[model samples]
Target: MLTAHTAEGELVILTRSQSLESLRERRKQESFYCPQCKEQLILKVGDLVIPHFAHYQQSSCRNSFSEGESPAHLLGKSQLYEFFSHHTPAVKLEPFLPDIQQRPDLLVVWGDTEVPVEFQCSTISTSLVRQRNAGYYLLNMLPVWIILTPQSIQTSTADILTLRLSSFLQFFIRQIPNRMSVLLTYHPQSERFYYLSPIIHLQGSTYAARHLTLSLHKQTVPFSLPSSPSQTDIRELALHYQSARRKYLRTVIAYNQKGIHNQFLRACYEMRIQPVQLPAWIGVPVQGQEAFRQSDCEWQLLFVAAVRETRKSPDQLNTSFFHTFIKQFDGEPDDLLAACRSYGDFLREERIDIYRMDRFTDGDFVYEVLSGRFLAMYAKN
Candidate 1:
C-alpha cells in the first residue's frame, strides 16, 4: 500500500479494490508529497492506480540539478556533448526513438547509425543497468557509456599513473567493459577532466553525495578506496531528506508551531544534514477492558484512557471535542503516546533493541526524539 514508513497512513492506489467514494474520503483525510525531489505527488486511494509513486513532472531530468546550473559538467559529459556537437553531426540530448524503450541522455546521429551517450551518476539496480544498455543496443544505437565522477576526486600524485584506483578497482571487480569509448573523471574545483583509459572499466556505482563527501575529505581524508554506494543507501537518503523537509514545512506552515518540525528542518538545511528517513508514526491499537493485565485504579491516570491535558488548548481548541481529547494527552492519542515515551526513554538509555526495531540509523536525529518527539502528528485547526 502507498503508506509512510511509520505506517500511520499511506496513499495506496490500486484500481481493483477501492471505489470512488473511498478514494474521495482519503483526499479529505490526508495529503502526501514526494520525499525526494521535493515535488507534490499524488496518492490515489482507490484501486485505479497501483500503489506506486509517480513523479509530477513527466520529463526526464537529464541532470538532477545537483550542481544547480553550474554550467553543466566542465570536463564532463556535457563537454563531450559540446565537442561532438561541433565535430560530428546533429547532436540531440535525451533522444527518443521508435524502437528504443526509453529516452537516452544523449544521442548523436553518426552516419547511418545513432550513437547513444549514456552518462550515469550514482548507482541503480543491476537489472536497470542491463536494461538501459540493452535498450540502446536493440534500437541499433551504438552505446557510448560515460560514467562521470565528481569534480574533486583527481589528485596530482595519481595523475601520472597509467590507471587510477577508481578505474582499476572496478576493472579488478569486473564492473566495466574493457572496450568502452570514453571514461572521463572531472574535478569540480579545477573544472578539469582526466581521460583515464580508452578501455573503460565500469565498476560499481557510488552515491554522488557521499562521493562528494569522500572527495572533499581527500584533501585530508583520502577518497577512492575502490568503493561504491549500495543502491538502498543512496535511494533511502534521497527519499528521506526530501520527505522530511516537506513534512516539516507542511507542519510548520499549517500550524506555525515553533518547536519540533520547524526546528528539525532548520537544523537540516542550515547544517546540510540529510535524514535517512522521514518521521513516521507507528500504529497503536488499544487493548480491550479484559485484555489489561491490571485494570484497577492503583496506577490510575498513569495508564488511563482519559488523561490530563497537555497544552491548554489555545482558546478555540479548548472547547472543541477533537481538541479536548488531543489536549488530554501529552504525546499521541491511543497507543502512540506510551510508544513515544517508552521509545524516548529507550533512546536516552542507548538501547540497541530500539534501533533494530525502529530501523533508525542516525543517532542524532533519533536521539532528538527524546526531547519533544513528533509525539503527535498534528491536530487539525
Candidate 2:
C-alpha cells in the first residue's frame, strides 16, 4: 500500500528516500485515496513505521489491503519490490488487479505475461490459498507465493532439515519439472532463502528433508532450487525412516489393549503374528501414505494378511479388492487407495510372494530395498 491516488487521480508512491518533513508536507497538501476502493485514505507519516496508505475503519473494500498487515509483511513486500525492480523495469508495487478483485503485494510483467507475487508472513488456511489461486487462474496468470520463514523453524544442519508437516507448510510444497518437490521459505530480516527439496514423510507430521540456502543478492526472479537428494542423502533418510518404523513398532507393542475394538491389534491376532514379529515389508513407507492417520504398518500388515489369505497372484488382485480393503480405514479413501496400489506394484515388480513371507524377513535386505527405492524416488537421473 505504498502507492495511492491523489484527488486528481494521479498515482503517488512514497519512497524510503523521502524525509519525514516532506511526507508530512505532502499529507497536508492533498488528500489521498485507495486505488482499489476509491475511498479516502489516511497517509500515516510515522518515524517508526514505513509511511503507507491506510483505509478508514468503516470502508467496505473487497480487497482488504490494509487489514492485518504486520511489520514483517510490510518490510518484506518493500524488499521484494526492490529486489524485483533490480531485474525488471516491468515490476510494480501493490498493483490492484481489477478483474480478479485481488491486489497482490507485487506484480511483475515477464515478457507478455503478468505474474502476481505474494509475500506471505502469516498462517492462512488451504481454502484461502485455493481461492487466491483460482482468482489468478481466471486471468490465466500463475501467482508465485513466497513464505516468510518462521522464527521457530529449525535446520538440523546445512544439508539436513526436519519439519512438522503443518497444513500451512503443505500448501507451499511445490513439485517442479526436472527437480524435486520442495517447500520454499524466505527470511526477510537476513535476506536468506531456504529450499527444502524432496521432502519425505516419515510418519505423522514428521518429514525428513535436505535444504539449500542462498542470500537474496544471489537470487534471480525465478530463483534457484537445490538439486534432488543424492544417493548418500537417500541412504541417510532410509536410516531415519527405518528408525521411525522401529519406534512405531515399539509403541504398538506397548500400547496394544488387545480389545476387540482395536482393529490393528485384532488384525495382528487374526494373522497369528505378534506385532513385533511382523515382516519388514509389512510397514514400509509409500509415496501417498501420508494421508493415513493409521501407521503404515497397521494397514499394510492387514493388506498383506488379506492377500495371503486369498491365495491369489499379484495380477489377480483387482479394483474390487482395493475398494474393499480401503473400507477398513478412516478419512479420505483416494490417497489410501493409491498407496495400497503402489505397494502392490512394488510387490509385483520385485516378484515378491506374499505366501512365502519367510524368505523376505531379513531386516538388512529390507533396509537395502528401502534405500534403493528412496534413491529411485528422489535422486535426479
Candidate 3:
C-alpha cells in the first residue's frame, strides 16, 4: 500500500524520490500499520521495487483490500488521485462505501454526485465487472474503470494493436461511426491515454484494432468519447471482412473432401451456389454480432438461403421463421436483432423490395423478402 498509518495515527505516503536510507530511518522511529485493518505493517524499502508498506507475511491483514498491490498499480492509482485532486478538492483515495460494501481506488464527490474511479491493472471476469458496475449504479455513482496498458503494447502496431478482451474490457466498448465499438487503456509510463477503436475479432482471443493516443498533460479540450467510425476505417474493415471470408471459404472447401462434415457448404454446392461468388450484400459485417460462434461466411450463407426460401414463398418470412433460422446458429437475441438490421441495410443499399419489420416485440418480428425479380437480379449480380 502507498499510504499507511503510523504509530502516531498519522498517514504517511512514500514518494518516489524518497531515499532508502531515509525510509529505513523513518521506519525505525515509528511503527507502521495497515490503513484498512489497523494491523501492524512492515515498511519495505527495496532496491528493485518501489518503497511501500506491507503487512507481515503471517498477518491476516495480508488478505485485506490494500494487500497485493503491485508497484505499477500503486503508482498509477496515486497518479490518478493526484490528477483529480488538482482539479477538485473532493477527491478521496481508497474510499470505502458502507452501503455497497466495496472500496473504490478513488472516489470524487461533486455536490450530491459521487463517482467511483477504478484503476484496473489485471484481468477481471465479466460477471464481476457487471456486478461492480451495477453496485455503483445502485448507489447513484458513475463508475469509471481505467485500464493500465501492458508492456507488450509498446512494441505493438501503432494503428492495429491487439489486446485480450475481458468482461471489464468489453464493458467500455463505445460505438463510433462506420466501425464497431472499442476499448480504452492508459499507459502510466508515458502518461498517455490510448483509444483502441473499431476492434475486429479474428478467431479466438485475437483482435485487429485501430488505436489513437493522447497525451494527458497537453490536452486543452475536454476528451470526447468517439461514437462512430470514419469512412476510411469502415473501408478498411470491409476489405478485412472480404479477406476473412475468402480464408473461411478455402478452409471449408479443403476439409469437405468426405462431404460428411460442414453440411452447410455441401448444401451450397448441391444448390449450385459458389461460396466465393456470393452476392456482395451477403457477407457484410454487422456491429455487436461478434458473439456468434459462426464465421461471417457461415452467417452470410444462412442469410442467402433464407432469401432464396423467402423468394420461393414470401409468406415464409415471419417472426417464427426468423426465430427458427437464428436457433440453427448459437447467438443471443441481440445478435439476431443486429443481423436483422444489417440485412435491412443490405436490402436498402441493393434497392431490393425486402421489407424489414419496423416494430419488433418480444415474440414477434416481420421481415418480408418480396420481389422474386429483385432476388434473381441479386443472384446474378
In terms of TM-score, the best-performing candidate is 2
Model 2 residue 97 CA deviation (Å) reads 2.1
N/CA/C clash count, model 3: 6
Candidate number of the best lDDT: 2
lDDT of each: 0.36, 0.76, 0.63
Worst 10 residues of 1 by lDDT: 281-290
Model 3: lowest-lDDT 10 consecutive positions: 359-368
Compared with the true structure, what per-residue lDDT tens digits does model 2 show for residues 158-240? 46655677878877888766435688888877888878777767666777677677888999867786775676776766676
What TM-score does prediction 2 earn? 0.85
Query: Candidate 2 vs. truth: CA RMSD?
Result: 3.4
Per-residue CA lDDT of model 1 for 1-381, tens digit only, reads 122111233333223245557656665665554322334445543343333333344624324332222223322444445545655657765444546546555677767667886555544465666777788777766676545553334543332122224433232122222211234444433444344322211112321122222232232111123223244433433343334334433544454344444433453343333332322211111111111121111111122112213322112222233334334333335433333334333333443332122343333431132112121232323
Badly placed stretches (over 4 Å) of model 2 are 15-31, 45-48, 56-63, 154-158, 257-260, 291-293, 329-337, 364-381
Q: Which pairs clash inside model 3?
A: 175-227, 176-227, 176-228, 176-229, 177-228, 177-229
Better of 2 and 3 by lDDT: 2
